[model samples]
Structures are given as C-alpha cells and as structure tokens.
Target: METTKWLLDPAHSELTFKIKHLMISNVSGAFKNFSAKAETEGMDFSKANINLTAEMNSISTNNEQRDAHLRNSDFFEVEKFPQLKFTSTQIEQTDDESFNLHGNLTMKGITKPVKLTMEFNGIMKDPYGQEKAGFLVSGKINRSDWGINMNVALETGGLMLGEDVRIQCEVQFVRQGINVPVEV
Candidate 1:
C-alpha cells in the first residue's frame, strides 16, 4: 500500500458554526478562510493523518459589527490568536459511513480534545478527472473552554449568548500527488 496526500478544495468546503443568542434564537456563522489536508494509505480513511486550520479573522456572521467583535479579545482575539486548528489523533469507524474522529482543537491559544462525528460521503471522479472525497462533520464545544468569556445577562433573566457552540463542516478533499489505486 502507498500513501496518498489530499488537499482541501476550499471552494467546495465550508466550516460553519452556530450558537444560541438572546437565549431564544441561534446565530449562524462561517469562516471564510480555512484549509485542511489528509494523508491516507489507500481509501480506508480510518487511519489517515488529518489536519485543519481556520483563520479567526475570516469569521462572518452577516453583521460587520458582530464579526469585528468576535475577532476582538472578547472572543477569538484574532490579534493574539490568529488561527483555530485541529489535528486528528484517532479515527474510529462506527459503520461503513460513520466515524468518531478524535482530535485536539486549538482556539485562542487553548488546546483541548474534541471528538467530531463524521460521515464519509464517499468518493467520485469529477468532470475534470480529479478524484474527490466528501465528508460531513459535526461537533460541539463550550465557548468558555477556549477562554471566550464575554457575555451579558438579558434583562428578562437568561444570558446573552449560549456557552455551547455547535460546529458543522461540509468538506471536500481533492486527491494530490500521484494517483494510486486503492485495493479492496
């Protein structure tokens, strides 16, 4: 078996997150700049070496003021911590399509273990003759764990923002280097 490297197709991949706001509704946002890679032996990605990084300054929530605030010390503090990163330590296959991806996530200079449930969406050959792999990833983490401890209390009683942030990713990887047939 030979190892093949994979690069993320940024145009076809997205990293998004959601958090409860005002204790009533959820606010959705996405990072506009991010990249990931994987090195795999054949097509069974369970043992792949995966890494991901996202630019904290590229966060977008549709509102410029809020986006700026998120980049400040109250949240990500992009000036001091410019990137959020994840490196997979283990991949546990739960089924043909499902997996538990164990990794360490670094945000705002804090690194913590996180497990993301992922679904392999299979592979395909695009019209451009490139082999592509798809995946759906989801996870949750407490914002406070990353040192983001800024929030206000609502006049009605509840807090301004939820502590738990739900992350979702629709990612696609394009095969790089020499093409090698994966054995069954």
Candidate 2:
C-alpha cells in the first residue's frame, strides 16, 4: 500500500451554511475562501486524515450589512479570529457511500467535537487525465457553542436568529501529482 495525498480543488468546491432568521426564514451564507486536504493509504478514505480551514473574512451572506454584522465581535469577530479550522479525528463508514466524519471544529478560539455526514461520490479521471474525488459533507451545529451568542429579541416572543447552523459543503479534490489547471 502507498500513501496518497489529495489537494483541494478550490474552483470546484464550496462551503455554505443555512440558519433560521426571525424564526420563520432561512438565511444562507458561504465562505468564499477555504481549503481542504486529505491523506490516505492507497485511496482508502476510511483511513484518511483530513484537514480544512476557512477564512473568516471571506464570509458572505449576499447582503453587506448582514455580512459585516457577522464579522463583528458580536459574532465571528474576524479581526481576532481570522480563520476557522477542522481536523478529522475519526471516520466511520456507515454504508457503501456514506460515512460519519468526526472532527474537532475550532472557531472564535473555541474548539468543539462535531460529527458530520460525508457522502463519497467516488473517483474519476477528468478530461485532463487527472484523478479527482468528490464528496458532499453536511452537519449541524449550535452557534452558541463557539461563543457566537449574538441574537435579537423579536417583540413577537421569538428570537431573531436560530442557534442551529446547518452546514453543507460540496468539495472536490485532485490527487497529488496530477497537473490539473485550476483558476483559483
């Protein structure tokens, strides 16, 4: 068996999240700058070591005002905590194509263990003859767990924002030694 490395294909990957707003609607946001990498033994993802990081300053919700608020001290505090990171601790295969990814997510200087579901989309050779792997990862976390406790009290007897944040990411990775030209 040989050790294989995979680098994130940033141009083909995205990290997005959804949160309830005003207890009625969902607000969507994404981190424009992020990266991930994986190391596996002979392409066995079950034994892979994965790491990921996202630039806090790249967080965007489409609306500048809301985005700015999220970056302030009331939320992520991008100035003090410039990046959020995750390092996989364990991976348990649940089915033929699905697995439970356990890792420690660090944000706002706080670290917490989290479990996420990962769907392995298999590996294929691209038009450029490069080996690429895809995955869909998703999970939910409480905003307050990372000390992001900012919220408004709606006069209607409900909180403005929900504590639960739904994370969804579609990521693609290119095997090391593959010369695939990527825009970003």
Score every model by TM-score: 0.95, 0.97
Question: Which digits, one per residue and each the tens of the lDDT, describe model 2 over residues 105-139?
Answer: 99999999999999999998887777889999999
lDDT of each: 0.93, 0.95
In each prediction, how many residue pairs overlap at the backbone (N, C-alpha, C within less than 3 A)? 0, 0
Error at 80, model 1, angstroms: 0.7
* Tens digit per residue, CA lDDT, model 1, 31-111: 999999999998779899999999999999999999999998888889999999999999999999999999999998899
C-alpha lDDT (0 to 100) for residue 155 of candidate 2: 91
| Highest-scoring model, lDDT | 2
Model 2: runs farther than 4 Å from truth?
A: 179-184
Candidate 2, backbone clash total: 0
TM-score of 2: 0.97
